[model samples]
Target chain A: MTTRAKQFISADQLLEHWQGHRNLTRRVIEVFPDKELFEFSVQGMRPFSTMVVELISIAGPALKGIVEQQITEFSEEVFQPKTKEEILARWDAETEVINHYFNQISEEKFQETFNLFGQYEFPVYQNILYFIDNEIHHRAQAYTYLRSLGIVPPFFWERF
Target chain B: MTTRAKQFISADQLLEHWQGHRNLTRRVIEVFPDKELFEFSVQGMRPFSTMVVELISIAGPALKGIVEQQITEFSEEVFQPKTKEEILARWDAETEVINHYFNQISEEKFQETFNLFGQYEFPVYQNILYFIDNEIHHRAQAYTYLRSLGIVPPFFWERF
Candidate 1:
């Protein structure tokens, strides 16, 4: 793919897209009852809070790594939230961290390959897309968990 | 959002990104045993087959509506696939259909507002995105179902 020659998305639009999904995910986090958020899982899927840690850990760190041109080991251990409020607080703080680093990325840099968490080697944009994609994937689980508990999720289309 | 002034994603990349998700969903559909695919549910969530029908009915039809500039009522009733093979067949055909109409949309048109199925009015690109996003949403339920059934799902990152 001629990454340098072709631009499909702008830095701003990409960030907005990522953040919109993040916004919806925040709603998912908000709606979860305190107990279920930390403990609920379908069969063997991770609890929404565990999933939230995985989501919280990625984008900001990955974007920071991309901007710094450094490969760091991925860790969710640093954030072990005991409550829903703790998870949401970290989520908000991480949003700022994401915006700070995300804005630093040049469009051309998006095409450059980065070994994310020193594991998955992909173009920077793909890695960023993974961050967004992974969140959506996990949030989908939380939605099912919510539904099985008889709660309606915020609409998927209402990203903003 | 200066939709015309700034191009964030090219048509090809957007379509490819979408198809990758579809490919993953296809694999998810493939892994389910016939009965579980048709009958299993977590609480009262729709069965995987029903979810697949909702998926099968979108994208191709939505793209067709966008290309034709006609708002048609959305329906999954037209494709009540009784077997896994039928779902896969329709899925493959719809993929081709999606490609055919998706390529017809010029970049400028991505920003145009269209009332999808006379229900959700959104930018054409967002509508297309909804198709991909909704698939992921439903597929997550299928994943939970698979795990509940003691089956391992395909890796989420291996979209291709």
Candidate 2:
């Protein structure tokens, strides 16, 4: 028979999803040529490169704050000019940090609620969703940017 | 013949992931008992309900702003205390709005970037990630809440 139905979630699985989603985001960045990454814009919006910088920023100190119960200590990352390669490099770095932190979570910690920026309170799982949801929100913008360029970014439907 | 193997990316696949991911976050709220939804917290945090309100406020207003290309005037969707049911209703509403706006994206519009909060220059794709990332971040906190209650959430592996 299949393994027991594990209704209880695992930090590993959450981390996996985190990794995969980041993969998708990075690929989307890759699909865009260097010119498109920095120059293209829909409605005079921020460039893709700027968006990637913001992405790099979410996990490093942000996750730490939620875990330790303090504000992120730095400004919410704002996008600025950066090379595509630089964006990708930071993406990889942030992924590593997030994975390392998530791996540290034990089952007991899952149910505990914590302060997110001294504002909202939620369980660790809910916080995980916040991270993912926020990324998807931003990714949606990327999808729009990709399509507007007539270069289809990867699919939004694949969960696996 | 199929095109080059570019990360095996598919927009449809990403959406599937997005939908599943969203459902995961929405479901966590349902699993949470009403009492804990409002008052519980770990290490002096707010409440799970508080985070949900923040979500409803951010996702809807952010999307509205992006699609309409003007800073949105938001209501107290995320401010003040909200019942679990109210949060659920808002969740449903945001989903509908996001899907509807996404449908309007055309190939030509991908290149047009909309200003996000007048703070940073981000491509449309980056903006979308903002939403996803925000959600996941919060969801992680929920996981902690569920675990602290000795309640195991759905297997995180299934999140994708």
Candidate 3:
């Protein structure tokens, strides 16, 4: 594959991983009765629904700001995740936002130096990896919730 | 709570979210048979373990960079997550690294813009939110794997 194709593939892999995890998590949620969605937990864990909202809130602006190269001003937006339909909508919105950012990257840009908060230094590419890394972290928890529910999610091997 | 107390509480909340989710995901991995951990998937999903590795590799550095405003230099190091033992070691190490940076943050830093991959711009705090957001994304996938195995990993709402 061409180098650019390869880069796109990385993004494709990320998107697949991101969406794949969500797909499975959704199954866990769908199986729940609505009341249980907010209230149930296997062990002092957040309810599946609460976690679902957690995922919903992070995508659009959180990733959006990073790709857009703007500083994030954290807010209660995350704490107040919208309805399921809204989460889905924001999820879709984040995809477009990410695609816009991903396609916008020139090879040179990836190599450029950028300051994170004024403390640590990083290249643009490194920041991208951070984005992917964080996704995997939380997805892992959702996996636990699924297992606790006794519903098998998608395979971990098929992430790519 | 006073405003500063509230902000601190929120920050703690975010950190706790990461920790709880990470723990839940790690548990999912522990329950998996080595074969299934690496091989099971339904459709367009990964082995779940790979996702964990990537998450482990990225979490500390990502947060440290953002909190410290450091520049990221992407290398094989960014993607080459270590073995389980190594990851566990690094995970502990990052806790210290992340703590140092978190303590160092000036409130102003949250509002300052950073060039994330030089693609889009965002405040540092948004990057923090993204960190939590992305973690949940991948953790959800692990939930899928747990269900597939006919094991219930844990409840989601019981985060500390």
Question: lDDT winner among the candidates?
Answer: 1
User: Worst ten-residue run, lDDT, model 1 chain B?
Assistant: B1-10
Which residues of candidate 3, in runs, are more than 4 Å off?
A: A1-160, B1-9, B73-83, B117-120
Tens digit per residue, CA lDDT, model 3, B7-96: 112344345445665666556566666667667764555666676666655556665666666667533245444345554566567667
Q: Which stretches of candidate 2 lie over 4 Å from their true place?
A: A1-160, B1-10, B73-81, B108-111
Please state the error at residue A54 of candidate 2 in Å.
Answer: 25
Q: What lDDT score goes with residue A78 in model 1?
A: 92
Scored by TM-score, the top model is 1
Leading candidate by DockQ: 1
Q: Of the candidates numbered 1 and 3, which has the greater DockQ value?
A: 1
lDDT of 2 at A117: 59
Instruction: Provide the overall lDDT of each model, using Cα atoms, as 2-decimal numbers.
Output: 0.84, 0.63, 0.54
The superposed Cα distance between candidate 1 and the true structure at residue A10, in angstroms, equals 3.0
* Candidate 2 chain B lowest-lDDT run of ten: B1-10
Label model 3 with its docking quality class. incorrect
